[model samples]
Target: MQKNGFPLDELDFAILSCLQKDGRMSFTVIAEKLNVSIGTIRTRVNKLIEEGTINIIGRVNPAKVGFGAYAQIAIYVRPATLKDKVAQKIARLPEVSFLAMTSGDYDLEVDVMCRDNDHLVQFINEISKIEGVYQTKTTLYFKVYKYAQPDLNLLK
Candidate 1:
């Protein structure tokens, strides 16, 4: 089935669903479970990766890694034309994990991770000094619950 200009067959969707459940699952195991040849599974998996349809990676807990402070910041750029440029510069900051150019009161939204409240303050100060940055509003995240992958069944 092709969705959003991506050509993905049933087998491709199955392979992706399986990997989403357990990214570490071996090709042999997946093949056995799916009742297909191991080589076929391997080829499909590689094709999926090459096509940028899926990515298998390990994710870490930010708090466990000493980044206890988390916040989302909304930035208003001085000129609308500078939004992308400013967002690109902010994306390069080490403290910024996620950045998006938005259309609303704020020109951009950023997710930042820091060691503590002091670190967050320092990071905010650094952002304030960037050119084209007009104003910013930040909301601290006390707890985060993330779902790595949503249920594939919903795609149906």
Candidate 2:
């Protein structure tokens, strides 16, 4: 593990890879595959979670769940100082599934999920009412080929 990078060893990478493939896989199964004890696997997984190295989560397909409107919105904030505040406000919105402070033409970007076109329009209208938000450009997703976290191979 490098000092400035994520503090993960080979075992940690292997554990993450296994979890990515099957988040519900038993620790015993992983241990058996890695030739480690169950207790060791448990301890290591706990440590990884404690250090914020990995998050075990159940993901759902938004489209299958009736959220058909998926859009990426770029928001331009009036004053640079208000960027964080606007992002926080946007992040609190239920429609916003993902939010990030960005360095580009836009100050912030958000991924929004809505039931349909009407819901999406309403959401965008609501966002336009935010005080510091000067402008917003929305790009609707026609299809999502992939939606998952970064591959564990990058850890190598």
TM-score list, all predictions: 0.90, 0.94
- Summing lDDT over every window of 10 consecutive residues in candidate 1, give the lowest-scoring window: 146-155
* Candidate 2, lDDT over the whole model: 0.91
Tell me the tens digit of each residue's lDDT in model 2 across 50-141. 88888998888999999989999999999889998888888999998899998979999999999998999999999999989999999999
Clashes of 1: 0
Residue 109 lDDT (model 1): 94
Query: Which residue ranges in model 2 land beyond 4 Å of their true spot?
Result: 3-6
Between which residue pairs do clashes occur in model 2? none
lDDT, each prediction? 0.89, 0.91
Off by over 4 Å in 1: none
Q: Pick the candidate with the highest TM-score.
A: 2
Candidate no. 1 TM-score = 0.90
Residue pairs with colliding backbones in model 1 are: none
